[model samples]
Target: MQYFTICAMEDTDLSSDSDLDALINCTLLYAATKFKRKKRIWKSSYLRKRETHGEFRLTSEFSDDQFTNYFRMNRMQFEEVHNTIQNKIYHEGSRAHKEITTKEKLAVFLRYLASGNSYKSIGYSYRLGDRTVSKIVNEVSAAIWECLQQTFLPDPTEELWKQIAKEFEQRWQFPHCVGSIDGKHIVVKKPAKSGSSYFNYKHTCSIVLMATVDANYKFITVDIGSMGRFSDGNIFSSSILYKKIQNKTLKLPEPDMISGGEKELPYVFVGDEAFPLLENLMRPYPKRKVTANYENKVFNYRLSRARQTVECAFGILAGRFHVFRKPFEIKLASVDNVVKAACVLHNYLRMTSTATNVEDIADEELLSDQLTSIRYNNSRNSRNAFLVRENYTHYFNTTGAVQWQRDSILRGKY
Candidate 1:
């Protein structure tokens, strides 16, 4: 009985040791797992803290002048834009527990637009990732376009069109001229899988900006995002402006008497030879090898002088916003937004600033004087168009003639 009692005691001792060993192993495993989880949490928190604190903090330190210099806008302008886009860029911070402020986003985006810096470079300056910089830029650009379109680039009514025509006739000395139309190639990086669709005659990848400018160098109408491979005529025909004019939905003014009521003249937009000569559009006469002293030549010279407005508008846009001067590395949609935003901002700046000199920003040399032969469809309509041109030519030479026009033409100065 004593032996059996001892054996039972030994068995109880061994079972207790086995239970203790299993319990100790379980505790060690739990401790290791807890440590690993804490380490992970600590790492994430450190990274988040680092990301939240950086050069972006310095934005608050800039003075008004510094802000204007950096963002290319005065404080009032900045606030206006920021307030307009604040709701669009605001982040609720629900999932990530971290977010960028709306003001900071605008600042970052404006800096990118003003400087045309690479995403990585902008990220470095703003203490953001390149992806974040790119996202903010695109969002802010799109927001600017959406929020300011109606205010800056509203559709013109008949009175406004007539006013523009009057301005052209008074300032440019081109009677019945409504606006100047032109096209420019905005260079861009080749898009993926685009093949040669974006390749232009200049042997570069680009998108076309077809714009109509009033006498004051403001964009009256603009059509962007056309393939650069297309000619100006092709792009213009496909534009919304063309459709509106064709359908007579644009509310253009009625034909009025010209040259002291001798003949009726329709309000027209003057373009270079790359545009078609329509009932409401005029282009230069095709150059002939044997130059003649015909009225058509004088009319071409006058039309060319008026067409300078659109070219100057483009020059001012590119000069003020250097982004257009460089090849855009963004996607096509982003480029569209950027271009629209720039145009709106251009008009805004022109309307607000008193010291903006067009001569200072525009390169007069960039204006083209050479004319190309335009392809005319519909023979009867072509005859009518030529007749209209002839009437205008006669008026310019007679009743509408300026005192110095003949001298200027003789001096080869037109």
Candidate 2:
């Protein structure tokens, strides 16, 4: 070996400046090529091992309970969603390599939503890059919102509204009520260049989720991505739902006769004092200096009871998908998609889950009242709205009264 090396160096003419330079360049190029090959080998081996043993693999290995606990969904539900959005999420493999399966992408998205894990942490567990994880999560969440909106949260027809009103009456003992309306602050990271627009009274950066829920704790309609600094009344006034109601374009059912009286009333949504009282919307009487009469008290209690459904819906939403419990460290648009997806998933789960009692999942802490003061609208029909409220107050005290309503009012147990 020594003789061959000496002979090769003698033949290569190491004495010339140009030859030496060529030799050095060639040697450096050879070394770089060798290093790159070794790096490729190591990365391929690591990825193969990770694919074989990482948490993504465990998803298939897990038992039913483990699967449910990890993904916050059953196999059937996962398959249903996967099938609906398979075309959207599917990526055709190229000659370079096989694309990640749609199933894997969905699994990553669900795991992120269920665990609320950071992108880096989730990517590590799933053997993906953080950017890939983020891309998959956002894509899958947007697909969920688009694919499930019609089936899970379609606008209600007149008949459906009446059905909702009937459910409210039967389940909550509230007459002529269709749904409960409320708003929640979805905490988020401070947005770039957003000043105090997203800063809420709670001192946290957030977006508002204004939703109307039916008696079964299902979201009938939702208006999300409102500025957190806006009041609930302001948010509602700007919502599409409110606009439809205002223009009488929602095709609400005709007035129905009160159960025990000849007076007919339009179906109305029940809200708290943070909302303005309208002919089609009822809020509790102000709890300030004005003493609420017995009839007003009963009406308030009944409205509160009905309004509890929307609160409980939010509770169940946060409890099941705990991502809402923490501040989402993402862009504002991404947060909106995440929230919309969560809302649709909440409705889907509620429709399919076997748990009959809402108390099992409802987070009462989220339902606590946030009403600050009575918000009065400056509409021309303001006095007429008050008279409408008074009429309902009278009806609750007399014809539409319930046996236990009086006792509930007396005990101050709304």
Candidate 3:
């Protein structure tokens, strides 16, 4: 009930010396203070008595039970917990990422991500061998992916789908919308034998990651094995998504909003022009003149609103993993795992953060233009809009495309 405050260390930061001895000693105290729930703890110089032969040492006045009850540790017990996390929790075989503990590994990774530090620089700071530092980072990153994929992503259940449907109505004014689908390229170090196969519009050789994010900006699906040289269109057509659509294996719920309609409405997913048009897939109509003025703009506007989640999700991923910002210079096979880990960590951070709400974007032409521009650039290979047109044609046949036509008219149709 009471908050306790006191400095555990003095002002000189003597606890942060380069020696391993310092790490052992300081980590012990850090674990002790943290375990005790002490709010203020310091590590620095302790004043010495000039009259004494030895430097003066002050006893920390703690409750007699503080050792057993508060710290829950004896000297041996403290070392065991410290060793467990150091050896087990963050022990990625990667030489780049090794540190004292999982917490330390996370700190290093976040620091590297937040500030683009060279491996040598990070190694120097963490007192790890340079090569060891690289392995540490990669291994720790893999662990993050393992944890997140296991904890966060699962096939959405009916309840989850319903929640997604509700969010679409409130946030994007598009009912029955489950998630936004898109692909992003991550720059990577060019492999020895690979050539134009990895080259992308960004003028970099990289891997492409396809993702589906729900209205809340959480990834619901992911496929991350294709080369960056592949167009989003090719990635989509060749992906498991296309297979699922073909096999009818993707079990989707019927939208309640369309329950009363006589039309044979199936569950729908939204994507850009790069993805194949299917009965369940909805994309913008091919660039066409609006017979009903504004209809084209309105449809594009609505589609853009629903599709923004994938863009934001990618932004968060890239911003949080600088490894993605720079092309990786590792083995090509390892690239998939790194991309997978970055995405999983991204979802993990989003779930753990206090800010759970997706950023609200204003409905402005400038924002639309920016989104359109990025899409065009990313989808340049699929410039013909073949997939989008195919889907629109199918939907037109099914719903008579009349309601869509009417809606287009009311909105000055696209």
The TM-scores of all predictions, comma-separated, are 0.82, 0.87, 0.63
TM-score-best of 1 and 3: 1
- The models' CA-based lDDT, in order, is 0.75, 0.79, 0.56
Which residue pairs of candidate 1 clash?
Answer: none
TM-score of 3: 0.63
Across residues 259-309, which tens digit of lDDT does each residue of candidate 2 receive?
Answer: 786577888999886777788998888765225577667778888999988
* Deviating ranges (above 4 Å) for candidate 3: 1-99, 254-264, 289-296, 356-414
Off by over 4 Å in 1: 1-32, 39-66, 94-98, 357-381
TM-score of 1: 0.82
Writing each residue's lDDT as its tens digit, candidate 3 over 136-245 gives: 56766666565457677766776776777678757775556777888776667787888788787767676777788887777988987687767646677778876776
Number of the top-ranking candidate, with TM-score as the measure: 2
- Relative to the true structure, candidate 2 reaches a TM of 0.87
lDDT of 1 by residue, 1-414 (tens): 334444554555445878556555655666776676773342243336534465557766789777766777777888887898788888776454567788888888777767778888887766667888888888888888888888888888899898999999899889888899887778899999999998877777888887899998899888889887775467778889888877888888998897574888888889876777778887777667116765666787788789888877877766565576568898899899888888888787778665755543554344332111122322223676777777888888788877877777777754
Residue-level lDDT for 47 in candidate 1 = 39
Using lDDT as the measure, the top candidate is 2
